[model samples]
Structure formats: C-alpha cells, structure tokens
Target: MPTPALAIVPLSRDDLPVDTVELARFMIGKYLVHDTPDGRTSGRVVETEAYPPGDAASHAFKGRRPHNGSMYLARGHAYVRLTYGLSYMLNMSAEAVDVGAGILFRAIEPLEGLPLMEARRPGVGLRDLARGPGRLTMALGIGQSFDGRDLCAGQGLWIGAIETAPMPVGVTTRIGLSRETDRPLRFFMPDSAFVSGPRKLLESF
Candidate 1:
C-alpha cells in the first residue's frame, strides 16, 4: 500500500447545492486563480460571507438586476459587482440556478503572483493586501469583465485545489450590514493572516 495523492479538481455544481452557509464554509480552504494578460495570480480563500435570498443585506433580495444577475446563474460563475460605487467585490454563485444565493470572497492568503497582485494594487501593506472584499478583488484584478464568467469552466478564472488543510473554521456574524446582521453566516480559517474584518480574539488577518 502507498499513500494516496491529494485530488485536485474544479468545484462541481454538486459541491455548491443551494446552501449558502455550507458553500461559505466549503470555500474556506479553496484556492482562487485568475489568469490575466500579466499572468496567473492565485490565493487561498480565507474569509467568506454567505448571502441567501430575502436577507436584507443580500443583493438578490430585491430581485436580480443588471449588476447581480450572476447570482441567478449556475454554480461556479463569478458574481463580480461594484460596491459603494468604488472598487469591485468578487463572489461566486452557489446553490441551484435561480435560487439567488452566493458566497462573498472577503479575503485570501496570496500564494502566487505577488508582484502582479501588487502591481494591480500598489502601496498596500502586506497583511492588508487582500484583507477585505474590495481589496481582494483589486488584488486579483477581477473586475466587471469577470462578471458571469464560469469559474469552473471558462478561461482566465477558476478555483484550484487547496494546498493546505484548513479546518475548524470560526464563524461570525456578517460584517458591515445594517439589517439581518445577527446571522452567523461568515466563516474563516481560524488564524489565516489574510482574513479580513474586525479584530477578534480568535483570528487576526
């Protein structure tokens, strides 16, 4: 007998299955890869927030619009959106088609193409590079053009296998929301240096 190698594969529709919170936890250790004109840039997912339909903080709660239409698509598509008319935020569609659910990528531990990421977002401190949703998208150069791209199928963007085991995730209430804020829909690696949000005793990143 021999030790088996880890299997690396793109996420399947079955992996997402219309459960926003489950999908949020599922992405904690996954990797996000983006291939741009500069090259391939990737990172290990660290923090995530789930948005199910009817939640006051969810973009889809009001129904699909031009900006958030990707949330209604099949699994593995990017739900890139402009937040507060400033930088973009990257999320991945999860659950069933037309179910209106998604997982917002709040932060990632940069594992590849550091220079490229830095060039996209200059002068940011190391720990602050991808420490927030807007910062994460900026660091990865994921913009409006990436909207609706099939992360598991299309070119230029997709998730990769986790390079490390990330277990015992910490759950917290979703951040910066005005309503439906009591739900513990946010999950993050216990102590990943790339995780973003308020200072907590358990995790700092």
Candidate 2:
C-alpha cells in the first residue's frame, strides 16, 4: 500500500530568505516535492549547506558562467548541477536577481512515493534513499533540466511546508570542502535520522 499523502502547502518566493545562510537554515523542515510522470516523490528537507556570495567553495565564487547562471536568478529558483562528474546536486538560488549564491540541499527524509524512490535507488534502505545530495536528486528524478526553474511556482518541483512546526535545527561546518571548511554553514534537524554526514556533527545536537 502507498504511504498516505501529507499535507504540503506550497511556499512562495516571499517565504524564502534573501540571505544565503539564513535561507540554508530556513530550508530545514520544509518539503521538497517533485511531480513526475512516474509519480509524486516528496520529502522533508533534512540537511543543507550555504554557499554564500564570494565563498570559495561556491561554483559562483569566480563569477557566473553559462553553466552556473541559474545561481544568479532571484531567490526560490533551482540551481541543479552535476558534481564530481558523477551525480547531480540540487540547490536553491539564495540571493536577489543577478547575484550568485545558493543553498545546497544535502538530504531529505522520504515521505511520499516510497516505492518510486526505492525503484530509482534499487536495494537502498528507506533512510538511505535521499541521505546525500546526489542521492536526493536521483531519488526525486531531478536533473540538469530542473536548473533555473522557479520553485515558488508550486508546480512540478517546489518547496512546501506542513502545519507542524520544525524541530530545533543544529549547526555544523560543511562537509567535503577544501576551502571555507571551518564555516558553520551547514544546518540540519538534529533529531531526524534522514540527515547525512559524519556522526561527529550529530554530536553537536
């Protein structure tokens, strides 16, 4: 049997914070929904990393190019990218128009369409389905085509929220970055088993 659908209310652009780091923190407990031909796969955002303007770890640090132009769009837009020449990572543009900054969605707790997520990632456990940035995108059927798409539209792929308030968010330094590694820019729900990364970070919670 399919899991019962949760009440996910669409969030508008006004709901998005203009500050990069604030947006990263704000995304926790929000829902990421993808409506595809296969089915609707949705999850609660569990982890995120902020790549603010001028952050060396950001792709836009050197300034926008053809590939990263999506990061320059106004807030609430998708900035999907293929990292390490392998998997795709999903990000939300976090600044005003023409400014390059974004929040990388690291993980999500599988909520709706469990069967669809399982099919996309065969043999993976439920908690591991979207435990990482790349895995999260794959599980939701997100790809490069989703880049620059407006998330505030509340159609297709969008960010939403439920009535329940979010738990306290924990802070930690971002993972797997050579530069700006000491910055405490990563945020996650401390109690959520769906959040990915080292166990030491969880100790902070």
Candidate 3:
C-alpha cells in the first residue's frame, strides 16, 4: 500500500530539473514532506501547474529577478514566494540553473500532522486543508524562508516517493492566467477529492 511517506527522500538534481510539463505530470502521487516545530506534515501531490522557460505566465520568464531568482537554482529546490501579500506560494525548481523552469504545487491530500495543520488553518475542513498553493503552504508551515532550500536534503522539508501503485495523472492547460493559456501544462490526480479548479477535459496518463 502507498501509505504516507515518512522519511525525507528528496528528488535528485539529475532526476529533476526536467522540463516543466514533464515534471508537473510526473509529480502526481509523489509525497511532499515538511518537518516543522509543530510536527511532520506530509501529503500526496494531487495537483500541479507547469510554467516553462519563456512562459509569460511564469515568474521566471523575466529571468532571475530578485523575487524569482530561486527558480534558477538547481533542481529539487523550493522557490517559495509571498503571494497577494497574504499567503506564501511554494514552487519546485526544475530544469538546470538559468533555464528558469518551475512546477507549482497546487494541491495535496494531507497525510500527516493533521492536528498541526488544523491548528494553523482553524475552521478549515479536512478535504480543503491543502486544496490550493497558498493553502498548502500555510498548512505545511512553509514560508518564504524556504526559498532555494534543497528538497533532497534531509532538512525540515523534502519530496519523496510512495511505496505502492501510483495514481493516474490528468493533464490540461494551465489555469487563471492570461499568458500562454493554451500551453497544456497543468497536471492533477483526477480521483483526489482535494483537487481544485474547474473540471476541464483531461488527457489521461
């Protein structure tokens, strides 16, 4: 069975830093684990959106700006940013340095540290715990301090695999953006109740 991943086995640099489209789809069913002072929180990746190099919808499209410079680092690193000045958005840096490829983690099915998460987002339901990028970061206690942190390192945060069968991936175009809207880069696990956004037609994986 693919129980919640406990240990931190972050994705390798060589394995990652792949194209944004490929990594976005490939990350489905993988686990993102974070250890905080509250406790260890984890979840199965349920949704993601990809932003390739030169993508106008991407922060890295401008190339190594002060805010998005983390995206230019080695693969398997966190590129956390403060969004809307109210929430933190967590993105995984993929592709080689300077290529500016990244995958946004849109949602996750919470696996561990429910109490800690609940305490963080009080009055939130279980299924909606990490249903969006900002919410996921808040739920996992991830913040801007994590920018450029190595996910493969056995630090407070990491990404790892499950022990059982993988879930099917659903792919479609990226959402809520004006630029590169038709680029077919979003990926999600269809069966996950925690997924967000409109239910558009998806290509099966």
Which number leads on TM-score?
2
Inter-residue clash pairs, candidate 2 = none
RMSD of 3: 2.9
Clashing pairs in 3: 17-95
In order, candidate lDDTs are: 0.80, 0.91, 0.84
Score candidate 3 by lDDT.
Answer: 0.84
Q: What lDDT score goes with residue 182 in model 1?
A: 83
Local accuracy of candidate 3 as per-residue lDDT tens digits, 27-108: 8888888876556889989999988788889998777888888899877788998977998988988787777978999999
- Error at 17, model 2, angstroms: 1.0
Q: Candidate 1: deviation at residue 27, Å?
A: 0.1
Q: Kindly list the per-residue Cα lDDT of model 2 for residues 122-180, writing each as its tens digit.
A: 99999999999999999999999999899999889999998785478888999999999
What lDDT is reached at residue 25 by model 3? 84
Q: Using alpha carbons, what is the TM-score of model 2?
A: 0.95
List model 1 lDDT by residue over 17-71, tens digit each: 5677778888888888776766777788889999876777888988878878899
Better of 1 and 3 by TM-score: 3
TM match of model 1 to true structure: 0.88
The candidate scoring highest on lDDT is 2
